[model samples]
Target: MSEPALTKRGRPGYDQRAILEVAVAAFNEFGYDATSMGVLATRLGLSKSAIYHHFSSKEELLEQALDEALDGLEGVLLEQSAQVGPVIDRLAAVLRGAVEVLTSRLPYVTLLLRVRGNTDVERAALARRRAFDRSVSALVVEARDEGSLRGDIDPRIVTRLLFGMVNSIVEWYRPEGPEDAGQLASDVLAVALDGLRVSTRSTGLDRLDHR
Candidate 1:
């Protein structure tokens, strides 16, 4: 038999998962709306028809990629460590789990972060993300109530700031870098739970009495 045909990119045998990886990368690099089926096909070195053989449309690809990120995050809440520990420990588990998810699924998480709710796929992803945030906020509140975390700041603000630090990793983190996910998670927890200073003496926030 003749040699198998190659795509324009000189590859053969594209599968759904491979197609999604490329699509998510393109979506993260260029906005989702701007990254179309044509763009994916071009990048994959395959024809649009070959792509459609795996997915009905670009929206399906987006939905699948978002699910990859959201499912991993939601699963973190279900872990035994996250479920049955002291609320402070549980919150730490969730935060560490979130970091693990982000680092392991960097491309998918990056795409999830960039979604703006412009399409139904994006809106659904946002809804799921908000639900995950709410769960983390609840953990924060419980930790404060148990006196493990400080009670001064609003739990909502604490949750936002905490995840803000976690999520910002998407901007500059590289899988090939020196720090592994576990180390990075430890660093995040140290900063969040302990603090930048050696001692815990209060200064600016205490003086402001913003509460």
Candidate 2:
């Protein structure tokens, strides 16, 4: 397959990254299987050859777009915040980072979340996502072992519950919406790490007596 090469001028500043971002949005709007190269070219206001200059095929575009999504999520694990803290703190940092990545790259992450793994690219992306989950679950195990997280809950289940809440943001979150990424991240950590109900363990069940 021919790699993306810049030759003829397409839309202004229509480089590979730009094209891939637009393609991600398109794929999110119209499912990847339904989006044709011609439709993608139309979305970019460019000819088919122009898109071909960037991506060899629709599948190639899908691969790159999914890569963008996976890269954003995976990069968070390597951040200093995720690595240097106590296990629960590290988990909080990872969750916050994941939320920021999801909201900032809404279209790409949305496309990533929707993949059903029918294609090789989808399968690869799914693999990377599961690997990320395992890494985070490791933190949960550490936190549980050290008595930070609740010992009654399985570490793997805790990891899934926390991540499930984070991942669900892609369903309704919008970059242009009222809540920004950081605020949403804070709220997620607050509710996930802390109970939604009044802390009966801390204040006693008498706090519930008022309700």
Candidate 3:
């Protein structure tokens, strides 16, 4: 059979997914304003026209990438809130799910990281990001009210700090090839809930673990 029009190592026709994957990498490494469609083509070893066929422009690709990362949080927010057991448990579910999103959608999450509220697109992305943050903060408030979270820390400040740590993972954290994403997520949740701040009495998770 004849080889396709464009393929990896020049074997077959272009795969839109492969091309977009390259584009996402480029955008993540270089800011959206700095990355060009031509650079994306070079990275994938495909023609610029091939990328254009899949996405109209670099901004469109950015929009698409951010959508994938941000959308994952929506379902998490809905699912966690519906659990009636405890607020801290719900918040743990959120942070853990967020870490899963971090690993599963690395490229998209990286792109989301680069947005700085400079452009309209970036600003809109920031708004969406904050909305998800507010959702998580709401859970933190509930947790504090239920006596799970320490009353000394302001729920709003704690929520911001928690997400700040979670978001910073994109900067240097990479998923280990042999590590389980689920287990990693659980560990992160446990760390946040239990905290580096050790308690003399039974920990907040005592209730969760006994149930």
Model 3 residue 142 lDDT?
Answer: 86
Of 1 and 2, the candidate ranking higher by lDDT: 1
Error (Å) of candidate 2 at residue 7 is: 8.3
Instruction: Report the Cα RMSD per candidate.
Output: 7.1, 4.5, 6.2
* Poorly placed runs, candidate 3 (over 4 Å): 1-11, 80-83, 177-179, 197-211
- Ranking of models by TM-score: 1, 2, 3
Tell me the lDDT of model 3 at 75: 68
- Whole-model alpha-carbon lDDT for candidate 2: 0.86
Error of 2 at 18 (Å): 2.1
lDDT tens digits, residue span 55-109, model 1: 9988999899999999999999999999997999999999999999999999999
**Candidate 2: how large is its RMSD?**
4.5
The list of candidate 1 runs beyond 4 A from truth reads: 1-11, 200-211
Worst 10 residues of 2 by lDDT: 1-10
TM-score of each: 0.88, 0.88, 0.82
Backbone clashes in model 3, listed as residue pairs: 6-12, 6-13
Best by lDDT: 1
Candidate no. 3 TM-score: 0.82
Better of 1 and 3 by lDDT: 1
Candidate 2 clashes between residue pairs 3 or more apart in a chain or in different chains: none
